[model samples]
Target: MKLTDLDYARQLDREDPLRDFRQRFHIPTNAAGEPVLYLCGNSLGLQPRGVTDALQAELEKWARLGVDGHFAEPNPWYSYHEIFNEPMASVVGARPEEVVVMNSLTTNLHLLMVSFYRPTPQRYKILIEGGAFPSDLYAVQSQARVHGFEPDDAIVELFPRQGEKTLRQEDIEAAIAREGDALALVLFGGVNYYTGQLFDMGAITEAGHRVGALVGFDLAHAAGNVPLKLHQWGPDFAAWCSYKYLNSGPGGVAGVFVHERHLGRADIPRFEGWWGTDPSTRFEMGPRFQPQAGAGAWQLSNAPVLPMAALKASLELFCEAGMQALHQKSARLTGYLHELVTSIGAGAFEVITPAEPEARGCQLSILASGDGELLHQRLMEADVICDYRRPNVIRVAPTPLYNTFEEVWRFWKILEESVS
Candidate 1:
């Protein structure tokens, strides 16, 4: 059967092992009460049906136990964040002690930077990808400025070769070597937001370490979307938001992974807080701060029970489905989307994302010709919920958890019509 045939797409869906997982989420409906073609999991994931019950459980605990909920039965509020350590570690492929669910994405980045980005007068530059997500760029810029250096001088942005859509691994390695001993930190996004490029994080980490620089990644697009081995890759630190591929709600609790090598190191400077103190001694009311042994020490405040509850619901689904399985399904699903988009004739649009299945996750960033915004509006009117960047990029993620192959096929038809 032709790949463009609707029957072929439906057959793929029928044979999908992950097909049953789609029903776990609450898909949004159009005016006529049909589910919209939701391809925006790269921006915000569909709500898991389990989220309501999870939130209600916490609310009920608060109502019944009040402050005593801190130590109450089932999942206690005091140690709420502890439950995520192992599960989140599993998602990112790290040791349980190295992972902790904490503050928002950029907030976690800043906190981890406080410990990792120790800029000396000689080695003061932070290397990042060009056209990084605005939040990451801002965070690194501010970190450099805080250390008394101009942003332009202290930050080195890596761009692809002339006329290239995505960066090559060789180029990234060459850039790191060029920076050499002068580089203080190598901070990058695990997946480029604009191009949907999944960087070779393990290689990047290795290269940075060879140059005596600490490396880290903002896994906003990578987490849950791709299978990561953070421990084996051995980046100094990493952080990610649960809201996107993790399918946690908006403004959901974010997470951090501090390499076990950095755990309990007294030399590392971090902004300390009461909750970060040894939990056994946290209630001692002592002035001298004795930090917890692992990533938990980075916490500044007690867990936000409600937000964590919402995340916990989503994490359960991730845990059940498993990252390896999800990633395999993601590659196939996104590969289908890529095939459909590219088959729409070369002049209509360009797929800026890497073609290799291993080089990306679920997203395929289409650089539409002419008015991309008009095409985006047309997609919205057709009840397709993908996202558009300012210039010409349309990011469509056929998330493995809830999105369907049929939707991808229908989206291609709509995109072809809109472009013409």
Candidate 2:
């Protein structure tokens, strides 16, 4: 019997060590009162059941103490962001001092660029993937314009070859070498949002340094979904949003990773605010700014306590389950989805994500052969929730945290019926 049968899916779910984790999240229900087959964690993860308690505790604190809650026990509002240092560091594979949970993804990206994208006449170009998320593209373009250089001339975008959807690692290394000393910085999405392809961050960082350029990554789609060793990879900096596979609520607090080598260096320029000041002299109202050591120095404002509360709930879950177990099950779960899609036995669509395990994460971007928009609408109507890009792709994410093997099988049925 084929493994795509319903019995096989049930067996897989029964044997899955992380099976109970699905109960921890509040899965959405359809009109008929059954839980929907939700595979949209790539866009926004399902809310954890603990989120309500987390937020409520903070709301009570604010009501009771008003302005004094910043010093309260269990979780002080003043040092709210500090609580995340160890857990966030573990999630991204960094030292506790190297990571900081702060502003949203794009905002953090712009802030990091201000300090790291130091363009000189000799090395003024920024290197990026051609099909990166639109927000990153806009940020990089504006950075060049702000530095008094034309966007077209100062930005180098590496694209795939003819009839190719995903970029090869060799091509990326070649581009970094071709740009050579002219490249000032290399900034890439650790996983391509459209194709769901995972770039070799280690190789990319090495190539950038070989050419005397700084390297960084926008891990919006990579973190929590894939195993990362940011400090070991030795990228100059990195940033990510928590809303997706991290299972944080919508618009949750984001985080950053700064290499230890840049610590205590006043040479790199950055935008400063009171929150980043040394805590010892922070309230002194001193004239000169003495920034905190490590990634804490990049913080620009007071912690947004409410959002951090929700993010904290999810990070707690991550620390407990551990990335090792999550990553191991993720590969198997995603592979099963890939198998089922290929056996659909009709040329209705194609999976554009790389086939190799190391070359992609949890998502599989399906390029519909025709009527892709209509197909997406029909899937939604059937209570199968995934996401669709503008033209052709339908991105389905089988998250290891809350998604199940049986759910993936159910989705395959829904997709097959809808397309047929």
lDDT by residue (tens digit), candidate 2, 1-420? 467799999999999999998999999998778999899999999998889999999999999989999999989988899999999998889998999999999999999999999999889999999989999999999999999999999999999999999998999999999999999999999999999999999999999999999999999999899999999999999999999988888888899999999977999999998888888789999998899997999998999999999999998888888999999889999999998987886689989999888888899999999989999999999898999997899999999989999999999988888878
Query: Candidate 1 residues 143-259, lDDT tens each?
Result: 999999999999999999899989999999999999999999999999999999999999999999999999999999988989899999999999999999998889989999999
Off by over 4 Å in 1: none
- TM-score between candidate 1 and the true structure: 0.99
Clash pairs detected, candidate 1: none
Root-mean-square deviation per candidate = 0.8, 0.9
RMSD of 1: 0.8
Q: Worst ten-residue run, lDDT, model 2?
A: 1-10
Q: Judge candidate 1 at residue 83 and give its lDDT.
A: 94
TM-scores of the candidates are 0.99, 0.99
